[model samples]
Target: MLRRTLLCTGAAAITAVFTGSLWHGAAEVRPGPGRYGPLKVPDTNGLALPDGFTSRLIARTGHKVGGLTWHAAPDGGACFPDGEGWIYVSNCEVPLLGGASAVRFGKDGSIRDAYRILSGANLNCAGGATPWRTWLSCEEIARGRIFECDPYGERSARPRLAMGRFKHEAAACDPDREVVYLTEDEPDGCFYRFRPGDWGDLTEGTLEVMCGAGERVIWKPVPSPAALPRPTRHQVKEARHFDGGEGCYYADGVCYFTTKGDNRVWAYDAASATLGVAYDADSPLTGVDNITGAPTGDLYVAEDGGNMEINLIAPDRSVSPFLRLDGHGRSEITGPAFSPDGKRLYFSSQRGRSGKPTDGHTFEVTGPFRNLVPPQRA
Candidate 1:
């Protein structure tokens, strides 16, 4: 199941107004820094990084403990600082075919604890971390729902069904605004935003879908309770909801989102509620699973389908190869999160072994990341 790599070179002209006509700008680009270090993995079918980068086995399939078998599949997750140790909220795609179990990994890579967060959810894709430090585990199923998990690996977590259940993917929150942005994991997926009735109270919220012009799409507020029954053909037929949205990150009054089936990243303006395309890969960048914005305003995208690699898109809309996975070609990379100190980058690989019945692996890449560029004034 290995696919060819697709690379784009040269820079396309991009023009935008900075300070009226007083400062028109254009971006200069070149070929991306190609693959670094050894591109082939050894022994295990995983990835190998450069000298400073290292990969370890946080948890894998069939690892037994306390007479309970650890589940195989893993997906979207986030890392939180808990006391002296770090706590990771991992997602288990499903229980049926051994897709169960979320583990809390300590700093030493040992499982501090584990729990089955969601049992029946299929394709539990990438999720986001709430400002309160809880994990919003999303289910990428036909009628998927988002589940909130405690950092201690507790099974008491429940699905936030009020968030408009439909192929749930990544969820990002604007802590200051009490607003949450969500992405759908479907072809032509719609970008959704949820505003809690009260700050910190997620039980009730207003869910809306992004619609209208490409760069002027407004968050057409939708009725959450009415959207609960089941989505109709007309409801899911929008072009934006067609390929299904994936990763979502909100920062600096803007929301960054990705489409796995379309290989496109879009940004939504929180002030005006407008949506615009940020980056579009011709091919090879297909199947982008999750996207996260760095402090430098650049975006890091995890490639789930096709070639397994992590790509970075600069603020100037220049896309380039960042990291490449060794050996396994189908390791669905998701959940790209930067450490609080901005030193290390962490991501999850859902399917290290290609074919049906895939098991995921967790990896960490340490590197220096630049902050995102501030948005220009209108």
Candidate 2:
């Protein structure tokens, strides 16, 4: 049942800035309609979707899908257009054996092929898609690095060490700014951006850490993106520290990211070099992890453990649960991305009902998402 009532909409009410310099403060943004309506009861697959939406299992860990054994602990993912069909790349968030895989779909939404895009990476967590159709697979380990993978499986994956050498979690490419924003999964991790020497070429780049507090922010070159002598975060004395940065996404001149430690969604306006808190712990959304936005201005944030659900943060800033995995209480929702046409969505349960990596399940939900209209203030 969708809530039709529209909440107040105006300037977000800033409440408090938790440490003055570290946090930009919390905001009470207005709530909007649950666009797709409330999630119905659990379906045949234990998924609660909207009225006209349905779910389908795409792949299960250790199971063969399109001739390839799906990897375990599926994490960050994205969809890329492939002619009349598309391809979905997902990360395997496992240590020692962590990697990433891709699944190709036909025009009829049928599985066409599945193959590996990246390998030999450890703790491959959340990552972002690039305009060039490459997937930035990030390794969430102490000495972890970023890998540029070809979603089409035409080229081999390569490590982009110049980006930085920390527990990298996610990357968001701001094509307009000619830089890629990244988030670290450390308790005191810092937000960063990598400026490649050549626009599409990420072979070499100058990694910089964010500094300052509040709306006005600045970037300072990271003494060593490789963290040779000192960790990148420690090298920048005045660099702002984020609480366990997780998923990241860039769109409409804003680079949006989530920090799981403090349960906040941050919006960095690249156009103005300003930063602000889009959502805080006070919102209905919690345990924020992987984030992705739609053409409709709706942002979908998956939960790591909060309710085993994917919540929608509407353009108006109102938050509500978009879908829920009914019986997978122990499991956390990972990747949440939409198809190129915006008619379908893809995501995964890192650890399914059994709470084991071997039981992970990647799913696809199809519905009338393309018709959603951003809620207006009442």
Candidate 3:
């Protein structure tokens, strides 16, 4: 039941950073352009955007986009190019019924087709896009795992058990180091990286947990990736504890991730083995969740609670609001992926105005994206 769309090939090295004061109490008021200007006001769709941007509802829970029904509780998402058009894959965050769906778009930003990419997965929360043109659909349960999905819908999705099974939150593939970084959503979750036996194969690999704090960190092998004797997080006693790991993304030479419990965004330099904070409560952004990078080197972070805004952290490290959802205070934003051309962005209001999973709403924002800027090596 899959529609054919020509798959386009490309590579992206998007990354972002922050270098401002730190705080833990409340969001601090900082001065920055926000790249775009001050948001005008909420439009008919209850969305506030910059001058040249406009928003449109793409799909809703139990609703049909193209010909297939959209998934519920849409969470992590990523964009994949298809010829001149593109495809956006969104995860379903509902257990048992939680899987993922894909919406195919034409070059003119029109919906061409929609279909299911993965099914029977439990609580597929947040996942990453692979360099080999696959989507990593991660489950958010105690023994959850990552499923490699074909965006083209030609192949069946497969579970990569080697990637470790432990309350998986998100996955980001670091092409430079040939390692896939992952996050867990537990109070004392551990940051992990998996090095596949082969560069593009996930069947066999060494699962290692990050251990250390401050500037430099190290990775220790997890004796049991399957968490047989104990939970994966507990297997590595020396692993650095990350409170509630959420979204994860890789760009340039760094891996960026968020810890919702701590309200902090972290940057890990693959080359130097260094770790640093990219954003904290000191900035305006809060309830940091799914993260994605822009062509201009800005990292867009969606909020799980605070203000229902998607904040942007520029390469210069300044924090500012990119977009905010009004009348949706009860809902949180999930997914924040940019179209392959960087001209459009897609995200979802997990609960929409009603704050119910069945009321989930996905939207698209079209605007002029500034020129691309490669982030300075961290």
Candidate 4:
């Protein structure tokens, strides 16, 4: 039941002209798959899924047919609702191979459309979805920029260079305040915020670097694109030296961001403009990547390194193993996004020693968050 409306050439031009204020129309509400619970994957490279969970090949690398090229290596992703189907915007981290592009998949698991969103950007890592229904794909390499891709349109995509380009990892937006928060992938990277002058426009915004400590630390602020010199780390060299900020999410008047190298999640209060450690694992075995809030207020963290498993940090500071790779070595799991209905979870795992294709694959697991055997209680 997937439906696609092809825009006429004239209509497409008009849409691009009005892209800045495109939020005027009502956003369509989409439904989710009715079923829920753990999925089943017959072949996990000796890995294991939850009891009933299942895994199937949605797409793969080098499996070309016609003009459509397979995804070389999939990275960050965001699922956008489109008619009866869903537009799964995925990031292809390959650069030299030249197959990296944003691919859209239908609800029935068919390639609806695909486009090269960002060219010459290497390691297009993880990014967040904006309230305006766009995917912000980040580049992990030095001097990387964030690009906003409208999966609904074939040619309405562009890079948002006003967001203070750096080794961009992930970004989150506050729809009510029209503020966008971004994370740097550098070891000493500093957190950033962009306050757009216009609610619907992002090109003209006030960029600032976070400074100070706790409540005292404020978004000291920086020059806008017009006044600022060439965007480089040297201009804000003092902001460097972070523990490695990656995943970010905006919810409940706060921005929850994570540091993958240090395994810590910090909450920045939008009202007070202060950052504090929200969650940290007791052991150093967990390396976190993209993080998303569950419908019930729990936070799900995707593990990029260390042991292969998704960790759930409950409200009461109780951390438990939600999903385990169930094999040997690291799993390199990325993007842990929840379905709109919050019944199912979607994630991607890069190539491991199990010969599961270095190109990476997306997996879906269903089930309510439940307790597993604790990690031996310290």
Q: Which structure among the candidates has the greatest lDDT?
A: 2
Global lDDT of model 1 = 0.61
Cα lDDT, model 3, residue 165: 86
Model 1, 1-378: lDDT tens digits are: 112122111131243212212112444323354323333444243555544455556555565532445555566767776654566555666544322344554565455665665566566667888877777878776666777777655446677877777777789998656788887765556777788888676888788776663444555666443445655213533424537677888777667777756566665656655554555655435577677766665667888766777776665545556666766575677667765545557776676665323465666665434442233435
Looking at model 4, report the run of 10 residues with the lowest lDDT sum.
14-23
Candidate 3 positional error at 85, Å = 0.5
Question: CA lDDT of each candidate?
Answer: 0.61, 0.85, 0.85, 0.61
Displacement of residue 15 (Cα, Å) in model 3 is 19
- Decoy 4 TM-score against native: 0.76
lDDT by residue for model 3 (61-82), tens: 8888999988889999999989
TM-scores, one per candidate:
0.79, 0.91, 0.90, 0.76
Which candidate model has the greater TM-score, 2 or 3? 2
- Tens-digit lDDT track of model 2 for 44-96: 88999888999999999999999999999999999999999999999999998
C-alpha lDDT of residue 172 in model 4 = 90
- The candidate, 1 or 2, that scores higher on TM-score is 2
Which runs of model 4 end up more than 4 angstroms from their true locations?
1-53, 64-68, 96-120, 224-241, 327-331, 354-357, 368-378
**Tens digit of per-residue lDDT, candidate 4, span 124-238:** 7888887778777887766677777765655565777787767788889877567888888777777888888886667677877877533335665665432245444345544
Model 2 weakest lDDT span, ten residues long: 1-10
Residue 29 of model 4 has an lDDT of 15
Model 3 reaches what TM-score against the true structure?
0.90
